[model samples]
Target chain A: MAKPACKNLEEIFRTPHGAVYQCNRANCFWLEFAGGISAFKASDFLHLKKQVEQIDVPEMVQNTARMADIVILNPFRSERCFVLTVTDVLNLRELLQGAKVMLDLNSMLYDCLHAMAV
Target chain B: MKDLLRLRTSLTEEIETLLNEQIKVEAHSSSVYLAMSSWCNRNGFDNSADYFQKQSGEEREHMLKLFGFINDMGGRAISPEVTNIPQEFESFRAVFETALQQEIYVTQQFNRIADRCFKAKDFMSFQFIQWFLKEQIEEEYIARRALELFDVIGEEGTGRWEIDKQVPKIKYEN
Candidate 1:
């Protein structure tokens, strides 16, 4: 018989990014790291560092910052993976204000989520 | 039993048609946003085009939402047949005004669908339409606000750049 499906969010996080996976059941999480492993690692690390700094920095940094919720786990052997869930895109806008950023990662993340919903 | 079966069949057909029409509307909305994006690009409004491109994605999301709903209900969602979208606009104001009109039309369409579901005693479908009804209100409000901003800038001719600068600040929520 086929193995029982992984249904929990933590079980879903076990699969590494960039691997083809599917969660066919309702209320299950499916992580699709469309980009290759290196890119996913870099983005995930950057987001984690940003989240950590936002949470720990001084009041000056805290005053103009918002951090997205992130879950990090060792999915595959020695491969650290992270997923960021943003409830409010507006909070990101407040965080990025007056900063000279090249690409809008917040918008990209929002689009990625929207694509998944579709 | 025969009469009840006929009534059920008729109700199913009607609901199917309405659902298909909604799919077409969503597709048409995507095309409309694409057209608006192209117009903005040609008119040196890159930020506006970006906004419309995001709007196009949202429209696709709307189509998929309806598609999932229909499939979940054991109903077939027909492929949408979208008309050619006009790519030219006289001004930004005109574009937004047209968008506002389309949102109003879509709200009316949703209301009609809700009414039909009520008549058919399909409370589930009627309840599902409530989300779209609420969304339409915000959609119209945004378009109307854009129109009002256009009027304000057009009247003064001084704040156009400022308004254009603000375009990039618009937020897109998933």
Candidate 2:
């Protein structure tokens, strides 16, 4: 089976854990994580990113057994939670890093092009 | 790769949002003072009207100062849209009461901004806001003293008139 190649959707970021897609048409983000997919508003996505980044992984890793503790992301709109282990968090960090870079890139390009046009 | 967000705005997203909120608060305070000025003028409190008019201008100046700082720091400064200004007051005393309340609110907001800057480790903004923190002292003092006129003069019969006459003279020495 082939995954649908969303030619129109912009790939904001991708990682081994998952990928984030920005749908320009809807002005929303499509997050594929942990074998599940969900759509999020830009604000919600940023909030989720902030929450994830704030997780105290290094301290938790040092204090607890790796397999026992988990990070839970309970999306406001959904009943389901995306549970994450320490390793999963590191993967999420990578995904977020990539997305952040792309966002920064897009912003710079827009600024540069606008400056040149002006 | 260039960090566009950081490069274009030294402010963190949270800090920028908070600063913009402060801008709106300042604009609202300015509009509120102008409305108070109008109310005073209508109620025959001519000197008090002048006092409020001056206060409104000062608030506007503060807003513009913050606006200029944000832009100078590479953050996009929003021209705030202010609404919900009161056009009338219960009395002349009430006008001073409201004015005191507004000054206190402004002081609290600056304190909040200072705290945010400290938490974000944005010492530059913290240092910049130090002037505002100091200015609030004078602002609160004048507002408090002006309100005190109602108490000291006793708003009975021509008492409000006397208080109104002295409004312009109510200056914060410190």
Candidate No. with top DockQ: 2
Candidate 1, residues A20-91, lDDT tens digits: the string is: 222233322222342323212222322332443344224433354444243233433225444433322223
Two-chain DockQ for model 2: 0.07
Model 2 score (lDDT):
0.81
Off by over 4 Å in 1: A1-118, B1-11, B155-158, B168-174
* Per-residue accuracy of model 1 over B77-135 as CA lDDT, tens digit each: 66788887888888876777787888888889999999999997788888888999888
Candidate 2 TM-score versus the reference: 0.64
Q: How accurate is candidate 1 locally (lDDT)?
A: 0.59
Q: Count the backbone clashes (under 3 Å) in each candidate.
A: 0, 0
Residue pairs with backbone overlap in model 1: none
- Highest TM-score model number: 2
Looking at candidate 1 chain A, the ten consecutive residues that score lowest on lDDT are A95-104
Q: Tell me the tens digit of each residue's lDDT in model 2 across A21-111.
A: 8776666777877787777765566667777888898776777675557878897765558798888888887887688778767876876
Across residues B1-174, which tens digit of lDDT does each residue of candidate 2 receive? Answer: 233345446776678778889999989999999999899898888988888898899999999999999888877688998888889888888888988998899899999999999997889999999999999999899889888888898989899889988888876776
Chain B TM-score, structure 1: 0.86
